[model samples]
Target chain A: MSAALVVLRKELLDILRDRRTLLLGFLLPALLAPTLSVLVPGWTADQREQPSPVAVVGAEWGGDLVYGAQLEKLIRVVAASDPEAALRRGAVQAVIIVPPDFTAQLARGRSRIVVRYNPADQNSLFAKQKVFQAVAKFSLSVVEQRLQQRGLSRAALSPVEVHEEPIPAGGGGLVLSLLLPLLLAVWALTGASHVASDVGAGEKERGTLEALLSAPVARPALVIGKFAATLALALASTFVAGMSQTVVTALAPAAWFDAAARPALRAGAVLLLAACAFAIAAMAAAWLLALSFFARSMREANQYGVPLLLLVMIGGVAASTLEGVLSSLWLAVVPFVNVVVAMRGVLFGRVDPAALALTLAACAAYTGFGLLLAVALLRREAVIFRA
Target chain B: MKSARVLVRAERLAKRFGTFAALTDVSFEAREGEILGVLGPNGAGKTTTMRILSTLLRPTAGRAEVAGADVATSPQDARRALGVLPEAAGLYGRLTAREALRYAGRLHGLAGEDLERRIEGLSALLDLGAFIDRRCEPFSRGMKQRVALARALLRNPIVLLLDEPTAGLDVVAARTVRRALAGLRDAGKCILLSTHLMAEVERLCDRVVILGDGRVRGIGTLAELRGEGGELEEIFVRLAGAGSVV
Candidate 1:
């Protein structure tokens, strides 16, 4: 434990002193969520505030559907000599081209609305839905007026009742999914891996590991201590990321921008999920660092470690949102998987006790595996000192 | 003769790497208060020979013992007797000079008041008082070497393996190191140091072993090795000359 403390303090100090590492492991994840939820979606939805362009050609109903004294206030309608030409020329997005019998069919309640658009146009689907909403509202008003003229109340001629119910969530989850990459995983890697390269193969390469092996501590205890220190840094990165997310979520309007929107996360669940996330991160860190004993230099170890950290982050991201991919027991036992899946479950407010248990059990199992990896690595002849 | 007091011995010590021979059939003996300098050019297996004696590397075919324990059979015992200063000996770059020595001491089972007192005492002797609390990364080559020496000396082991101990040192720094080594020698410590500098060998060593092409060419005092060749440098060249023996 004392040896481990020596390693842990050194690793943490290395990480804390690096400004870029602080920014990546602690800063990026917290800022990513709001940017994703608010900026991206807000820009995409901005079109709703603009007046939709509609053009008519050879329509028996004229622009009455849009510019009816009652509807005129709702839509801006334009007349075009060639309605299809207007749409093709980009003069208008959608043109309501009425058929010749459209006015007679309306008297008999047999009206049709044809919306022509290029099949490959991406936004046309959304444009079509908007057109339906506006046109449908106008049709309903026409029906009500027609009914009143016939001296019949619309509600008295009603049909069967209908009701809609929401389906329960399959999994509750985390905002860490989006925010973690920038804050915790990138820059934190250097501090987290400081002792890993230096202690493992770096020692071996420099011929110093033998001096360490000469110490009285049991081999496993030594490994555990080294493993613990490395694991601590990994957990620190995850914690930094988690804290950043909490602060940003609290302050960001994207998380709670609309008065009607509420994101319900139980305080206990947040802590439970964060704890699980840290556990997985720690195990992964220990195993990955211990594995780096094979690298010949700090530079090589980092090259090996970066890809591994990336794999962990990607695994975390995939596990959080990809329950289907993570369903197998194999993935559940993978170190970073347990943390991500549990976090996802917590965020979605559908945390299953069985899944949480599975996550913890898997993390424990991987910890044992990490111990085994350390043992195997430490036992090598090269571990003492090597070329 | 104090045969029972002999601290280290090696019989036919040889280490091989595939087809290449690193150390071939080398042997020696040492007792309390003797410094054996293994003088050779770089890549002449001085480090390899020391590594075997330190129990860091397994011998291919040899018998080596430290403090009466076989390095092959009783490594833990060999470890307890050995202190190593390897080439480019690494220190935790982030740790202070004091912390570096203390940490090495603690690894050997010293701690608490004992650890603190020993660290401070070692620091004062090594002239590390000024930089005791400073991180070791920014240190000059000589400073780093002193710290390594300080760590190696902290344990007061029966055997010390110093590889290229005087390489790349400035005049003042190298003299400080030499003085510390002289003190260790005076204190009845058995040490094996490797050096490229004949001056270092002449100044500190009681016996010098010259190696060439992975084999021992001769072992003697400076005067004896230089008898026919005039000076130590001339002797080195004449002996290391490829066709001279082969």
Candidate 2:
């Protein structure tokens, strides 16, 4: 066997024996997307279905006109002298303050109604929406009644009828298209980061690097072996995360899929996604391994690794949010962003094959550069013999 | 003695780390069937010389060869000819002693029955049979050293470079390592040992190379260095310089 293969086998075996790495590299990624997909929607649905408690300061003063029967059913009206205090303390989701002359003011022209709710609180925000809808409906009813008295139809108020015709949804609807690429970028970098440090700096810290270097193996072979191990672990994590997310998207209710995207699992699409994932994983592993080689110990590797990960994650988020990002050929040259943009394009059926090929080529180039840098660093006595 | 070929040779090796000169000028040779002790104190360039021999570091100037392979021109070949037991050599804690030896053997291109056979032979040779299958995490300093020794010898290297091989072992463990080195010397393997301990030199070295401030002060057998009969310590102190003695 080649020395690189031998070294790779030993490194992989070492990683397999580590329980912490196993948990981080495999188990955590497998559970991550499924947990978020299932739990978050389920929790949000429950919140939506349950009526929020709202405090109305002057319910009697409004005489059930402003607080109509339909509106009252959507929220349980609680009594409170200090409605604002109640909202702050979570005693109520929202506070609706109706003035004493609310009906009188409505007769004259318009009435002042204030809905106080915390925007930071989900339940409070939902309550505010419901309460505002009810008040608006009451005002519309009053306007319609007055219009009827004056022999005018509601059409008199709505002179121009605005018709909303949504453009046919493209790419795997907006949410899945954007979210999948972000997940891919995150897992690829995260998975590689987990093992790069251990494989590179951990070996030095444990004092095994010198022994390994003393072997008959070439320096490039040793580095390639270690790089392969790190890439394997990274690819494993990335693959698991992608598969989990795909399964979630497939199993999720159709209503959850935004736009026209609805879990389209074409062979070509799957292949494209797999290609994007592999490219991302390869680039991440090589970059992180290079950084790991530069570090003197595992602690220093982490200090370097975490920031790189965050920077990549931030780039991924930026790519996901950038409108029409896939159409731009310039993004195809950026490392993590290009992968994310390509993934989004693939998932949404907006793929530009030329752009994707460019992205792959760019990632390949970066990976090659990173591997070369790692090999060069490994050959440097100052780096290898660092205290 | 004249027929015994030189297996390890260093000629005018001078190394520097930018402004600091670690080795100014040093030369030595170890022949088959003998232990050559390179004696020096801390910062005496003992480790640096061993590192150069092991192909871990490059000498700034001069040349070195192991089993006829020049370390500078052909490091991989030089490494293949060497079995290096570095100072405070460490083991992979998760791997068993047997596994560690197998890994080392595989890297050297030994596999299948031959690799397993060599592992078994070294296990008996170093008395690693008791804990060969156990993880090295809880092994004592002596046990780890023995495992390291087994790994080094697995390649059947032409030249064995040991840097402070028994520096931290207990008396019993140190005796075991010393016995193993003596047996390897009798087996006709050239052993280049580096240490500052006078007793270690007195016990095992066929010839001593006394180094001070990266320069060789004396190189000869104990009897030859003693000349008119003197304590080895006094001679070492005098040759190596009294102020540099550790």
Candidate 3:
């Protein structure tokens, strides 16, 4: 136990000296997005709403127009001289014009209207279509009213009703999917690498491992001590990051974003523990063993270790993507996959008991494998003295 | 109860690396309150013998013991009575000079009052000064060796293994390490030191073992080795050269 503490203290001190943690774990995920958030509303609002003057151009106009109150909030109608020039100058999206022939064509019920605009222009298509719909609707309403005055109850005009029902996505599952973009993953990768490479490869690299073996502590004790220190660093960082992210999500103002709800948080906590246990224990073990045997130095191990971190992250992302498509309870029993599934379930509120159980099983299996590797690596002289 | 005879005992101990024999049929003993030097050239099995005795490596053949506990069967007991400086310093590079010593001290069960006092006393003895607090990353070869010596002194164990303790040290640093070892001897600790340099062997060791080609060629006092009245190296070459030629 004392031996483990020594390893743990030494490891923690090493991690503290790294500059990458500040940016990837603490700063980027926690603070970067909200800083960029202030621009979203203004930019989107500018694209949709218009409050400018514009020219009105109509082909053979003779349509009575009626506008919805909600529609009026976005656009203003105007008749301008030289409508083409107005559009070119960015005065409006398009122009609406009534021809001099006007109501005569509507009276005869045989008049056709021509909508005119430059076909080559950027806004020409939408502008052409929306103005045309408005004019046609207004003309139909006028015809209906005229027919009503004549006491005709014929079925000439009717409005089509289209109903769209939004399928409810499982609670907040959709929101959790967005976390892939931010580097919420950097901590796990860095933590695992720091530990495995430092204790295993770093020892080999620095030529200190042989000295440690000479100590009175049992071999397993040395491994356990090293493992405990690494686990503490990994678990501490992850839990802190997880909780902080949760708080920021919970209290960071609704306009900022909605956090995972209570149920998801509960699930997330469970999955997080499962993921962390698998990642830290399994990764640390495999890493320590592999490093002890293969690398001559921490630098060499880093070269090996960094790629693994990336692979885990990439796997995490891919596994998260598989949430709806390919993931099963069995995958949850696997190491990296289990964490991803569990985290997805917790963050999204859609995971099942079977999946969580399977993931737990996988974590246990990997941990056992890790312990075996550690013992084997510790005993190998070929790995120990390569440096 | 007044006499504790053997501090280290090795019998027919051998270490083989594939087709190469690092050490063969190596056997020796250091009694309590003595400094025994195991001297050889590089790859002469000096470090290999030290490693096996220190419990860092399991011997390929036969058995050895320290403090009367067979290292093969009771490695922990051997280690409990041991303080070692591997041929390599093996100091943790990331830690400061003081922190490394303190950490080692803590592991050796030196804590609270005992730990602090041991640290300060050793620091003054080693002339560590404020350099104790500085990270060992930029330390010179001698500085690292001194810190390693301090770590070895942490427990003041019954048996001390100094492996090339002054391998790359300057004159001053070498004197410091030697002086500290002389103190340990005065305090009545068994010590076995491994070195390639004959001067270090003559300066610190009361008796020396001449090893060559993975076996001991001769063992005696410095004067006994220099019976012909020439340099110690010439005698060492004569013994090792004959072994290699044969």
Candidate 4:
């Protein structure tokens, strides 16, 4: 164990000095989650704040009925000889055509306004929504005015009044429940594999492995020590990524989530998340180390490692898609998928102790098996001396 | 000679890699205060022999031991009793010579002041003071070899298995390494070095083991192998079976 610790200390120090590994394993992962979280929302909000430009045909026909009081704030009226041409050329986000008989129809208590917009363009789609809201508001105001003139209550327009109260879904908001687990698996796999390849096949390529193997240290001790280093970096990356996402989620605009049902994580949930991250990182480190040991060179290690990375990432995505459906004891025993399910359960505040125990146990078993395989590979002369 | 202890022994060792014999009935011994040279051409099993003694490779049909610890059965003990410098050994480029030596020492269970002292002694012995505190990435081939050698000798094992220790060095550096090996031998350390360089054998080996096609062709003191005072090259050429040059 002490020998293992010494090797661990040396490998960690070597990893720390490696700028590429540090950048990929820790700094990049730390920055990626928060950057995406901030950027996506910021970009969306920017788009929402800008008014969409639209061309109005027959603007004078309906007067206030055509462009309602909320119309100016929602859209900018752009001049266009051909409204459809303008919309297709992207000069205007949408074209509002007010028919010559709109006023007559309004007086008759019914009217149809044709709002032309490109469905493929985001700006055009948003403009369409705004125009619809504006027309609906104008119709409602006309109804209220007529009702008041007849001495009827304004509430008559909404006779079957509907009130919506969002119930907390137990899983921290939908995005967090899905996004966090996928992020954890990706960070853990990438983080562990980065250092694992460097320490395992990199040593073999550099010719340092034979010297290390010739040491009095046992093969198990050497493998465990290297595994510990890889695991340390993996855990650090997952923790940083998780914390970055958490901070972003905490500081995010409440309007982004269901105002009535914000995902709140308790202390117990946090502990379970940590345990889940640990299991994921441990599993990645063990298997990645085995793959690295199987490879004879760093390039070969990467060739072997990338497919496994893609496999886990695809599994994470699939599990996230099937989140609720994957809350079974059987899924808890699956490798990468189990992590996604457990993370979802933790975030959803619906922790199943039996399933969680099975997931953790299964991860531990895989890790042990992987470490044993790595040790066995290290002991093999053919692997150690492979081209 | 009988009073001297045999620290490295390879008894009728045979190693085959899936039918191609790498070492076939090859055997030799190195005693205390001796530098036994295993002389061979490129494919003559020199490295294979070194690897077996270093506990890196297990022989298929025979046993090898270092200081009575069987390399096959008691690898940890065998490794503890010997220090190896393989032909392709490399240093951690990120580690300084002192750091590399200290790491090797710690692995051999040496620590603190004792390890430091051992490292300092090796640094001076191997002429590593010029680059002891510097990282190995920028070191020249000679400097790298010296540091690697220092790392191998850090534990002061009873037997030293070196495979072509000065294969890539310039004259000055090779001379420095050769002098160090001679000093270590005089200090009662058993050194078994493999080399294709005939001059290295003529200058340093107390006894020479000539290997060709995975079999021992000759084994004796220089005079015994030379057989009535021929050039070492002619003897090597004849024994290695590459045919004579003219």
Better of 1 and 4 by lDDT: 4
What are the models' TM-scores?
0.78, 0.94, 0.75, 0.91
Alpha carbon lDDT at B147, candidate 1? 80
Estimate, for each residue in B1-246, the C-alpha lDDT of model 3 and write its tens digit. Answer: 127578888898899988899999888778777788987776788888888888777889979899988888888888889988887776666678887887777666677888888888888877787589988888888888878877787787989998888877888878888888888877888899887777777788877787888998778778898887988777888876544321
Q: Which DockQ-derived CAPRI band holds candidate 4?
A: high
Per-residue alpha-carbon lDDT of candidate 1 for residues A206-297, written as tens digits (9 for 90 to 100): 44565566554456766776666666656665565556555554455553333222234566876775677566656665666666666766
Candidate 3 stretches with Cα past 4 Å from truth are A17-173, A178-186, A240-294, A320-327, B1-4, B242-246
C-alpha lDDT of candidate 1 relative to the true structure: 0.66
Output the worst ten-in-a-row residue range by lDDT, candidate 3 chain B: B237-246
lDDT of 3 at B49: 88
State which candidate, 1 or 2, has the greater DockQ: 2
What's the residue-level lDDT of B77 in candidate 1?
Answer: 87
- Deviation of model 4 at B195, angstroms: 1.7
**What class would a CAPRI assessor give candidate 1's docking?**
acceptable
Listed per candidate, the RMSD to the true structure in angstroms reads 5.7, 2.5, 7.4, 3.1
Rank ordering of all candidates by TM-score, starting from the highest: 2, 4, 1, 3
Residue A342 CA displacement from its true place in model 1, Å: 3.6
The residue-by-residue lDDT of candidate 1 on B84-103, one tens digit each, is 88776767666677877777
Residue A351 displacement in candidate 4 (angstroms): 1.0
Q: Across the candidates, what are chain A's individual TM-scores? A: 0.65, 0.89, 0.60, 0.85
